[model samples]
Target: MLTAPVRTMILMVRHAEVHNPKDIVYGRLPGFGLSPRGEIQAERVARFLSARNADVIYTSPLLRARQTASVIAGQSNTATVRRSKSLIEVLTGYQGSPNSILVGGFSFYTPVKREGDESMDDVLRRMTNFLSLVIKRHAGEEVIAVSHADPIAILRLGLEGKPLTVENLHSVVYPERVSINQIVLGPDHVPQLTYFDVVRSMETAA
Candidate 1:
């Protein structure tokens, strides 16, 4: 049992590198796994989190994210990682096209077109709703959320009440391997970022 006001700590992490040779913006593209380097980075992230006391683990429904979460879970001996649709990467309007949306712009209103896709606003709303549910369900608990870059960035911006503009979106950079963002729940039940982009340092034994 726990007493006193408890703060829910959420560590939002970007998934490791993907297996995209041309690096064609494979937003929400299926059948893409992590590269070898990505696997190594995932292992590093796992090692970093294995020492912490995480109560729950949440991951995006994407393969890259699921693979990364699995690595961490294996290291921490945690079973049953939860999958959520809200954590999926941003749904770009253009799919299988070379002309993609520019990175680091935060314009959720700008409508891009893929054959069949949702708008940026729609994606943001769904992500926000999903985050709210997660926070309510896991209040005062330390959890790990492994998601893609765009969704993670959007979620953080939404929590801060910032407009999902292109500039603001472009400002978010995916941290190096095993970087952690510590979000502490305040008394008002709002999640605040205490630490952002703290990359775990390599161990140097004496």
Candidate 2:
């Protein structure tokens, strides 16, 4: 029998690279799955989390994030994989555009907010709300959440007491495709970031 602990452990993982051959912005678009290399990255993460005895996994409904969560669920001790809209990618108006638009700061610099866009505050609220429910429902259990970079970064910023702004969002070193952020919540239900690192493949001794 597994015993619960005094604090809950949450692993926030960014989904692996997508199979976007055209290099276009796929913001919240359907049908974008993981690339071949991304599959390898997911496997590496699975091994890492399996070692930690992760109890369950919650993932964004997007294909890429769901695919990554599937790999982890299969390899880890995780009993179930649940879908949560709170972990979905940020809603952007740049979907289907060239990736350069985002890289060039054109999107963020735009003076007017688009109809379907999600502000930093929106992201923070949903992420924190999801977190509160998770902490209440699974206190002291190890859990994994597979999501996109912006949502994970925003959540991290809020938890770390940083300003939730686009400037900080871009400036913060978001988790890589093969990385995970570890957040620990104690009896008081306060989230604290312990570490975030790339899940490099395990090394073997010669």
Kindly list the per-residue Cα lDDT of model 2 for residues 1-206, writing each as its tens digit: 11124678889999988999999989888999999989988888887777786778999999999999999889875459999999998887777888876654554324434775887788889998888877778887888999988888888888878887667877777788858888888755356675555554343321
* Candidate 1 runs further than 4 Å off: 1-5, 99-109, 173-178, 194-200, 203-206
Instruction: Put down candidate 1 lDDT per residue, 1-206, tens digits, no spaces.
Output: 11115666778878887888765767778867899988988898787788888877889899998999999889886535999888887776554555344445534336556444655466678766665665678776778988876666666676677777767766655445456666666466456664344334544321
Candidate that scores best on TM-score: 2
| lDDT for position 134 in model 1 | 57
Model 2 ranges with Cα > 4 A deviation: 1-6, 104-113, 188-190, 199-206
- The local distance difference test score of model 1 is 0.70
What CA RMSD would candidate 1 show? Answer: 4.2
RMSD each, Å: 4.2, 4.0
Distance from true position, residue 18, model 1, in Å? 0.7
